[model samples]
Target: MMLSVFILMTVLSLMMKIDNSISANCYTCNPCPTPFSPSSYLVRNKTGCRYCAKIRPDGYPIVVRDCTDTCEFSTWSYMFSKYSYNCCTGNFCNKSQTNYPTHQMVILLLFTIYLFVNKTSTKI
Candidate 1:
């Protein structure tokens, strides 16, 4: 019984450690510069926007002659089409991101139970 308890605690501690490490590396938004053009509408793209602007060589008196919406933002929902759009815009701790850790916790819980049962039923 004591051995089983020890093993269970050890496994739980290890799982918590793993969870902390994984969450530490989780993705977070960084303040990125706006890459959109005043003349053109912005659209989502893989890397960034791709538009043509006609500005003077001296960079004065800019004009919005033509524009296109070709700007893209870094969002988990955009990256993972399976996830809902709200996953990225709202809370950071959503199902999409918690799936992995939740799965790990479930597996660890099952394993711990199994170990406890096996240890108790074993005959010396």
Candidate 2:
């Protein structure tokens, strides 16, 4: 019974260590860049930084990726800039994506129907 208990404790410790493993690399370049992003540059992530950061401003062509000592997940807006700031503990997590929500298309369809109905009723 004592031997079994020791083996169980050893297995649990190994499992805990595996769970604590963190990605140790970060990309120091913007994952995605646009015309409005003055310093947009992208490069593959290598072993780097304590934390990784990506920032994008909504409806504005702004993008940033960086290595930071400390970071947290957050978002904010100022002036003409609506910013989404994301800070992650692992460095290999920054990747560029171009996407649009399907819900926006649904909203557009509804708007078009409303306009058509309003115009037809006015004429009648």
Candidate 3:
């Protein structure tokens, strides 16, 4: 019984460590301009107009239409990292977004560990 408990603890600890590592390696969005425009001169062409271009969170270039001005231009673009691309035509990466399945899995793992520990400790 003790051996099983020890193995369980080691596995749980390893799982948690792996999760932390994955989270650390996860990509993060660099701060960029809002209503990003590739041709707008309002912000000195590039100044105050931080931009990012990279693979979308869903692994697709976001389709964006610019209506900030009278004209509307639509295009597909990926914006994940700042200064990665000269022009952005869609929403940039927002790291605040959470993956429900991953979150649930972590929670479930923690809960299972809790229950296991409790059950093993009780004499009943």
Candidate 4:
């Protein structure tokens, strides 16, 4: 029972750590540069997330957060040259630019779980 409890706690802690580490904050605004304090949005899929801006160089911009390939931002950016686009992942990272994570931690977590299961099976 103690071993089971310990294992459960370890898994729970790892899950929490991964959840906190992978979450991203992005700046969200309908029209950029209008407000001094723009709202930030949360992204579920930290990978392939994007923060896009339209007409930023023109001084009036439309900024959006956590845009996927199916979003209008992707289409607009690909279809036009006037838009400034960025992608990134981190807490409030999109406040400046856009980026993405390689999900190394997720892969590592899966590997750890696999090893744990394999060890348990061997013992049984």
Candidate 5:
């Protein structure tokens, strides 16, 4: 019985480490400053990123795209130019400005789980 228990523990430990890899992927771009990044490069599984994002600052022709923790679309104006930002959740979601948040959708369900518990509980 002791040996059986040890084997079970080992199996569980291995399972825990198996699925930590991030399956989500996104297009990362930063064509500015030293070590310019290509817009076609694909990025996988950032430690704290749940969503992909794209932002274009005012007055600058460059747009930077990458992973983000949240999706909050907003616009900010600073002097001459207006910056527009858009966010979405899914794999390869932040691909382009006109792509509208995704081509290869991984789904919002991937990271979120909803439990629809009934408000009424039967009493025995």
Candidate 6:
């Protein structure tokens, strides 16, 4: 029972740590302009925790933070249609007007650790 309690506490702590790491704000706009300054807002996508900035080959840019449901997850690439997409996780990550690919590896690492701890706690 004590071991279970310890495991549960550890899991809870890890989850709290992960939850606090994400920024509460993100940039959202349609056809975000060059020399852009995007307005920030609290993220509402819940599971759409990723931030995306897509620049059409024509130079029109879209900045938004949403889950995979809203924006299809893809690696950095320019489709034949001449559209380039970049995504990163973190508040305001999409604020950059330049479509440089951003990687949220730290967030992924922490999330993985949280999941592992949670699973171990359940077994306890």
Which is the leading candidate under TM-score?
5
Q: Please, what are the lDDT tens digits per residue for candidate 4 over residues 3-90?
A: 7657856876786567544534445454444432443232222343433222243343555444333324446554455666554445
- Model 6: colliding residue pairs: 48-67
Better of 1 and 4 by TM-score: 4
Candidate 2 — what's its lDDT?
0.53
The list of candidate 4 runs beyond 4 A from truth reads: 1-21, 39-66, 69-75, 78-81, 97-124
Best by lDDT: 2
Off by over 4 Å in 3: 20-30, 33-94, 97-124
**lDDT by residue (tens digit), candidate 2, 9-110:** 576566545433554465555445443242434555556466566677677565666666555443223322556766555435544342232233455566
How would you order the candidates by TM-score, starting with the best? 5, 2, 6, 4, 1, 3
Candidate lDDT scores, in order, read: 0.35, 0.53, 0.36, 0.48, 0.49, 0.48
lDDT of 5 by residue, 1-124 (tens): 4565466557555543442233446556554322333333433334345666666777777776667555555322332256677765556666655446232232223212211122223221
Clashes of each: 9, 0, 2, 5, 0, 1
Per-residue lDDT over 54-112 for candidate 3, one digit per residue giving the tens place of the 0 to 100 score: 22224434422211211111222233332222222223222223223344366667768
What's model 6's lDDT at 74? 44
Collision pairs in model 4:
86-98, 87-98, 87-99, 88-98, 88-99
TM-scores, one per candidate: 0.29, 0.39, 0.28, 0.33, 0.42, 0.37
* TM-score, predicted candidate 2 vs. hidden true structure: 0.39
